[model samples]
Target: MAFKLIFAALAAVSLAASSGAYQLPRSDQLQPLNPPIDNLIPLSAYIDGLLTNAERMKRGMGPARPSKFSDGSVTRREPSSTPTSPSNPEPTDVPTTTPGSGVIRIHDPSSSSTTLYWVSKDLNNFGEYGRTDDISKALTVTLGSDSGRFSIRTPSPACGCVSDLPFLGGIMGYATSGGDLKSSSADYAYLGATVETANGSPAVSGDNSFTRATGISKSIESSIWSISSDNSLTATWINADGAMVDAHILYYAADNVLSLTADPVSFVNNFGASPAVVSSWLSDSTLAVKATAAI
Candidate 1:
């Protein structure tokens, strides 16, 4: 019995020595021991071995077990807080058509309103017609009639223009260009009208001739003239007499009556002298008109 006890004690000692050099302390407060070697295993390895041994002891090795693995793709992950550089930055929304390039009219018969499009082109030009009292957005064509008229009245850019007519208002007629005037074109201003016949028609100097014959220095500075569908010539002018004139010269094709208004009322330099009171004078106002008639 004494020999048996000695043999059992030796076996226990051998098993303990083979298992590990020292027992790992249960308390987490203890600082784990590390081996002083070039290639040293971390404290976590010892803990992992301990856990494996404990698990093996609980469930004895029976058969080969399949290893478990987590899929990186299937794992639910959070978006990175750090911004990543994009290969191609997202493109911004761009408009298909440019503003002021051309007119885009929308007529709503249900609402009985026609929406006109007139974007700002030149520096002095505005986006909408008739924004100024002298100008009109009357460019709508009559249905079944190949005739339309639009007038643009604007100040000469930078107080300087080809006419050298001070910073006065000048006009552009869409009808003069046969409704083909492009706002995008650089030659859409008075400066573009270099000669009398540069646009489509020459300004009628018949009135100027009449005034000159009467010993008057009355002449049209920048004028846009168009013939109406009924063969009537409509002329809008910036006259040298410092007045804006809209003349309707009618000559009936049937009767051959060359009619002109006698004693045509003239507006003062700024239309604020006889008819308009000087109290409500528009100091820096001038009138310029250009009409493009269907005829």
Candidate 2:
């Protein structure tokens, strides 16, 4: 009888141990989910990682994007860097695309830093200095009905890019480049536009533009000045119809200064349409659209 009782007690303990809380597991704190941003990551990737790790250790995580990434469970992606760096000058030993080639590498104009390829070769950025927008994400510039694309890595670079810093609200600032324009470019400075979630309200949305160049950046600046607008800053550039003009802006950032520039637009003339004209192109007889910035 004693042996029988002891055996029953032991069996009960064994069952409990096999199905204890530790065994069941804690589903609430699931492991972090990581998505591949392709091999050879960029500063943006690293910045993304740091923010994610920091956020993951917290409670009540939110979405990544309103379109897709937002609803999925929150998980941190690794920053494509050494996990840390000082301001822009500190080089984060990361991978990069060759210059004038592709973006295994890119230059951060704001600080002349670098990292791997986040650049979009939408048009013909050629990944050179002063060839594309400095503030916006790699532009999706296009040319020819065939739908080709290219990228501009930096207005200027110092090898690697400044480490990505998500907490800073997308590197708040206006980005001006010493960049030039290319033929395989877009009518607008940039496209495939995306709005900032934080900057939401009944007001003006952020906008960037490109035009066919009629004059030099220095000359255009002289003719272009702001008159007035409800918005904080207004910049204007001068160019002729069928010329390439480069102008870009990124609003709702953490900074005040606006980076601005103008370069001539280009045309492969896919249809060979009478030597490519601006969206608002005019005949010589008609007024060349009065050059004025409204208040």
Candidate 3:
């Protein structure tokens, strides 16, 4: 039956060529040839052999034998390198930062010092300073999407009775006077937008200025804030003039302040003619420690 099927396929090909639908070589095309009767095998048997060879290749083994019926052109299907299922997935590198609640610490990148951390100074302002003996002063940070919020683990009367104040008012810039980081109620804030006070007053203006008792609004933070795989923090925003502004955190030693600015050179150059110095632009190694579970 297999031999008859092969002959029928060949006949169809000959018919098509003769109709000028296809061209064939001017040779012994469609000419009947004598089969090697002594060595001839059924087409079904030959197909079974090929299937068997395929199974062997899947098992990462070579073909058992060369074909004797036709040209020795048996190609092997190489095993796929990709994982077939979740049960046997390839290993992947773990990410440094995962979305969720966490606490953040800062250190000196040059020295890898762990003593310094992100702390709330003067009740409302933020700065990177030593918090080695006072863990309560450390800021509990939560980040998701483009938004981030900072709060204290313990509220102190000295620092004001507020516990949940939006860090930097959810915008990247200098701290403003008469503004506290605490709110009388539980509220969230978005980045790159104006903040509001608990009394429905504008907390921080859209221009990054702060008024009394103001906090940012509850919205997704601006895309300006990004955390790299190494936990480096960077801020990129568009100014009113439609120009891109890129900035990194810098520590002003004299004022003990951490401010984000695109130009560190000018800030250092115009250091108020004082003996105070400003640290170099902070990088992930210097600015951020690995995120820890929220306290």
Best by TM-score: 3
Clashing pairs in 3: 109-286, 165-181, 191-221, 195-216, 203-214
lDDT of 1 by residue, 1-295 (tens): 9999999999987888888954544343322111123432222211222224443332221222233446523332333568566596432221112222111122212244343322111222211111111112211111111143223223222112222121111223221221112222211112121112222232322121112111222222233434354333243443334344443222211211111211122211111121210001011111111122322
lDDT of 3 by residue, 1-295 (tens): 9999999999998998889888644342322111123432222221223336664443233454544536756654433467355575323321122234343444555554445554332332321222222434433344434333221122221232222223333343232222222212111121211222222222323322121122221222133445666665554434434454454444544444444445544444433211212221222333235323322
Q: Which regions of candidate 3 fall more than 4 Å away from where they truly are?
A: 1-99, 111-114, 121-133, 146-167, 170-210, 213-223, 272-295
Candidate whose lDDT is highest: 3
Q: Whose lDDT is higher: candidate 1's or candidate 3's?
A: 3
> 1-295 in candidate 2: lDDT tens per residue?
9999999989987888888723433344322111122331222221233434434223122323222356666544544546555576432332122222212112233443344223322211111112223322332211111111111112213323221110101111112222232235322222211122121111122211111011011111211222222212122333333232334432111111122323222211211111111111111122112223221
Cα error, candidate 3, residue 54 (Å) = 86
Candidate 3 positional error at 90, Å:
43
* TM-score per candidate: 0.15, 0.19, 0.37
Ranking by TM-score: 3, 2, 1
Name the TM-score of candidate 1.
0.15
TM-score of predicted model 3? Answer: 0.37
